[model samples]
Target: MDKFILILANSQSHFINVIRISIFIVMVWIGGLKAFQYEADGIVPFVANSPVMSFFYNKKAPEYTTYKNPEGKTVQNNIDWHKENGTYIFSYGLGTVIVLIGTLTLLGIWFKKIGLIGGLLTFGMSLVTLSFLITTPEVYVPNLGGDFPTPQFGFPYLSGAGRLVLKDVIMLAAGLICASDCAQQIIKSKNSISVNRAKF
Candidate 1:
């Protein structure tokens, strides 16, 4: 038991690094997906509903307003307009930014300053994503019992996309941990240099 504890303690830094890399993979993969039409279309509900992000869409409607479908309409007109209004471009741009963040974070394994900056960026992005929980009603499972206002499936009862966005909470925490670790490493490096100079 003692040996096991000691081994676990020794592996803490490695575990953290693994977590950091995992976040990088997730960010990069999801970001890359944004460049595609399907991915862009999928995020429409979340973005369109957000007070801060609604401007990205061509037509601004209320959070739950069902757009009128034209007669013989096989396609969703609102979504079509959304795609035409540079949704793909916006998604591509966002994807590029996310990929950049992940790249910087991965580089942090060698460069502390770069890593710290990447960590901060990742943390900020996580906050932005997590905000969707409050601003986007689609994140929750709607109550089947109607007539009255439908109660949302809150917290642990997150719907599919809700689960996806909620994972950002973990990413946010990981980013903070990585940034703090990098800062400590930078400080220790500086101190070591100072001590070496004094010895000379």
Candidate 2:
């Protein structure tokens, strides 16, 4: 039993590290996907099939257009969200912010503080996504697919946007784990500092 406990304690760090690394990888990948036009094809289908996302699919949303600068011969960009409703702006703005948060968190340079922020954002998004799934059941089912005509959530069902939805949910879990670990470390460090000060 003593040996078992020792092994478990040692393995805990490894497990935590794995979870943190995975979260970092996921965030980086997502940021890359959005920043660069790489393999973004999946987003459209997933969005179109998702009941929640379908609303935003065919939106003739006005986008930022760029005009060539006469002198610099470079494109001048401007925001045209005025043409679209707040939904588009909110979604776009939140998305960009989330990506930035994830990137900063992944750096591990300011682990505790940034981890907490990332975790909160992830938790909020997860709750929102899950709630949306509950509110819009029809969107849970895919409009096109083979073999599995209907989405089988199995056991404790989860509403997902699509394949990517599951990924996001998993990523969200990773974020929470990272946050918890960071918080624990912060508390431990503060307690240690207090103990040393008392000795002095």
Give lDDT tens digits, candidate 2, residues 1-200. 99999998889756766766666666555655543221232233333344655565344212221211232233223112222323333345445765766665564435677767766676666655554444433335533446766656532354343334555677667767777877887899899999999999
| lDDT assessment of candidate 1 | 0.79
User: Each candidate's root-mean-square deviation in Å?
Assistant: 4.2, 8.9
lDDT of each: 0.79, 0.53
Candidate 2: what lDDT? 0.53
Best by lDDT: 1
How do the predictions measure up, each by TM-score? 0.84, 0.56
Lowest lDDT sum, 10 consecutive residues, model 1, at 63-72
C-alpha RMSD (angstroms) for model 2: 8.9
The local lDDT score (0 to 100) that residue 102 gets in candidate 2 is 68
